[model samples]
Target: MAVAVNAAVTLPSSKTSSSPSIRFSSIAPERIAFSKGVGYLKNGLVTGGKAASIRAQVATETPTKVVKESKKDDEGVVVNKFKPKNPYIGTCLLNTKITADDAPGETWHMVFSTEGEVPYREGQSIGVIADGIDKNGKPHKLRLYSIASSALGDFGNSKTVSLCVKRLVYTNEQGEIVKGVCSNFLCDLKPGAGVQITGPVGKEMLMPKDPNATIVMLATGTGIAPFRSFLWKMFFEKHDDYKFNGLAWLFLGVPTSSSLLYKEEFDKMKEKAPENFRVDYAVSREQTNENGEKMYIQTRMAQYAEELWELLKKDNTYVYMCGLKGMEKGIDDIMVSLAARDGIDWLEYKRQLKKSEQWNVEVY
Candidate 1:
């Protein structure tokens, strides 16, 4: 059990930190220039200036209109008219590449200026539709991504939303080279490009109303998005009505140091409030576990398994995990082992956490 502590700290940009050597030199240059937000694109693909601001809606649907796979919850959940059939048009504010010049993957910090009409809470996700007509002459479908900004918006003005996106590269089964259609579309977005957005979707990852509840977060790669929102609400933004008095411990995993998105901001918060914030990194390629295996978040968790178990037993603690679903078993394996130390059945123990609404997971 720990009480809140306060301190001041600073954050350093990614450019000033150590990063991995990028492996894809050939396909990278094209993506690099389009990645910097609010910066000049030497190729003239983008207009150089401040991106348009948020606060006006375009494209509304009628009440009788129906959208496929509606995002509303069962209890007549609050939802906006922006559905798959009709979506709000958002202006591209910025697209800044945050990874090193040689990192293995491409990660971008993107900001979308939205009309103030999209009401949302922390931990919700937004869907993006790439501009193009499919072979059937229909608009490309919307792809959902977690919202990386706080509920109050990037500036606490409810004017903008943000996302951390990674470019996907893979070889197609037909022996053709391919990149993610939607991901590259977003990565290539120019400052003035318009995007279709829908839904503030999902409440599973939302933060607890209790300002003093301990938050244990585990994320890998772009999964860090929602945690960014949680942290911003807890430390970065000032809510005169809400003051954080509990501890937040974040465990993050990545292929290399360069792949750590928002590292500067996380470090800044950890430094500013050492008593209230803590961060742990598991760089798979850069670090190794005691077994000499590549260190992932699971291995890092094992190192502190006992302590984590203690925290889980506390009713005030809530554990949230967001990332690729593959890591689920690795995490569960460790949890099972740790719970055994207390003479408890791990599966049953997990059930209790879920029943109490203390365990939240959003993975795919």
Candidate 2:
């Protein structure tokens, strides 16, 4: 049995770093502007000076008051009352195009901005509304995508929210080059395209706030986006604090090495938390499988079941699953097998996960 000698080394971000006041602000207002103007269209409701300017314009056009009054029924019974919430209502843009991949398949990375802040826990997703009708005269469709950057990276002082997207290719009833409305429109977008989007939903898949909690991230394909957001939230913004004592592990599965997103950033994260962070690459087409078939994270989990189980057994450990739709079952089954080998009941293991909120899966 070979026990890996991985010594922990605390990076500069750990000391007084968890506090934003301590960590040297990475994204300045200027950088935020550049990201909003140049990068993804960003979310539409993020609050900041940039968004405030837009809201001021809207207020001038629409004079609305926050009225607080109780509605009375037949006997003067208070039925409903209007209570003011945040006062700031987010505005959505319709069909705003930002960036596109002009390949055979029309994939995209669009952005939008908002008048109010749309704060989110890392790994949360949002809903998108497509434009126009399909070839079959159906209304535009809706899809969900995870936020690739942190709220701190894009909101408050920042002006944009970024998203990683893939165009859906499907044949409509007309048998023409019918494709997904929103995705195709996004794919054809130039720099100034715009669209409507709402929300930062999903409570099940969220990063633990405790800096000491370990994060085990597993994803395939574009599923890497939310993990990237989590990585940056844990490593980049909080780097100087030396406060995040948690171990961050990333198991990324892709078709090929070339298709691996954020390779450079992953290298940087490893350099920052050499012992505290570990990344496993599962390239199905590029690497030969030990079982003589295409490799995946499921197979990798099986190969290192004991170690994976040990990592899961640690205190304050969190598991996040993303990417392909079927991975949750495969990973869960592997964990169950490992639990059975350790004389732990599968049902108890699940209860433990629920109690600790250790197991978090987001598949689409």
Candidate 3:
């Protein structure tokens, strides 16, 4: 089952000069109607209208499990035994956890682990099955979180995948706390609690197998997960044999330097792979420009438009992005502007890149 959440902001009639903003909750299982951005409850009671179909296919399919040796005899032959693996079992590995706060009420990073070999690619993510009940007496929900650790952190694909999680806190219709299910569960885990998990999903954010391809990574907030994996697979694993053909360019943005994830690791990479790795950090809420203005990744890209064009024109360059949904438009505009300057049509560049699998994105 799913629940639909809708939020809309309205000003007083006297102060209603500006347009309102509306957002939907992807977490819900039911369809909700917003009449002029106002939502009303209709639980099995029709409001003089037909309802949308509630039956829909979900893409995030869970892996099926099979039962093993449940009815084995002394000689190992079973008698009428056929059972699927239970869907509710998982292990706990990381007991003593660490918590760090970079944002006041927005994001928090939770570090934990589960026993067993959880192998995953550099760009994959895991779905967490949190164990707890909500205030409504419902079991806590499952959530997919991008793995932030490098492939090296996987310990030959047997270790845990470190996760960087963001907490979502909102108020309910009754002015009560409506916390995010998985985020708060992760944040509140004690030393011995267990967390069920499935995955290592996603294919679009993977690193290139060819060593000679250049990598351009664009990310914002916790979207840095896959790039961390890519970097480790390249530099940490020493995949650059004869000559590293790719120059790794990373463009990351956050509200402030303090909110930037993996700062220490990126700094270390800067010192080690100084020639191949280029980093540009856009701290939007602090450190104003010379004209006293804030900056973002798109703004920084504009500042380096010439170099960006050169890199994009490279023969085997791969561009990967994971971040907020609307930021892609800004990136597209910049790329189109550059394409126009280069005497090339925006559609040509877009189609060419799509044909070569050079353009990839994972936005939420």
**CA lDDT, candidate 2, residue 179:** 57
**Model 2: per-residue Cα lDDT over 277-300, one tens digit each:** 788888777675666877787876
Model 3 spans > 4 angstroms off: 1-102, 106-116, 133-138, 154-157, 172-175, 239-245, 289-292
Runs off by more than 4 Å, candidate 1: 1-80
Candidate 2: stretches off by over 4 Å: 1-107, 134-139, 154-156, 170-178, 239-242
Q: Give the TM-score of candidate 2.
A: 0.67
lDDT per residue as tens, model 3, 20-126: 33344442322222222222111110011211010011112332332212111123221112111222234432221112334535443333443334555567777
Prediction-by-prediction clash tally: 3, 38, 6
Residue pairs with backbone overlap in model 1 = 7-272, 21-102, 22-102
TM-score of each candidate structure, all chains considered together: 0.79, 0.67, 0.68
lDDT (Cα) of model 2: 0.56
Ranking by TM-score: 1, 3, 2
lDDT per residue for candidate 1 within 1-364, as digits (tens), equals 1112121212235566322122222221211111222211111001123110100011122223222221224343335548978888988866666788678978877768785767677788988888887779998888999988776665445667888899998888998988887999997776677989899788788776668778999999999999988887787665667788999999999999877877777766777789999999999999998789999999898899888877776656788899989777798999887667655667766765665567888998
* Alpha-carbon local distance difference test for all models: 0.71, 0.56, 0.57
Output the lDDT of residue 302, model 1.
Answer: 88
To one decimal, what is the Cα RMSD in angstroms of model 1 from the true structure? 15.8
Predictions ranked by lDDT, top down? Answer: 1, 3, 2
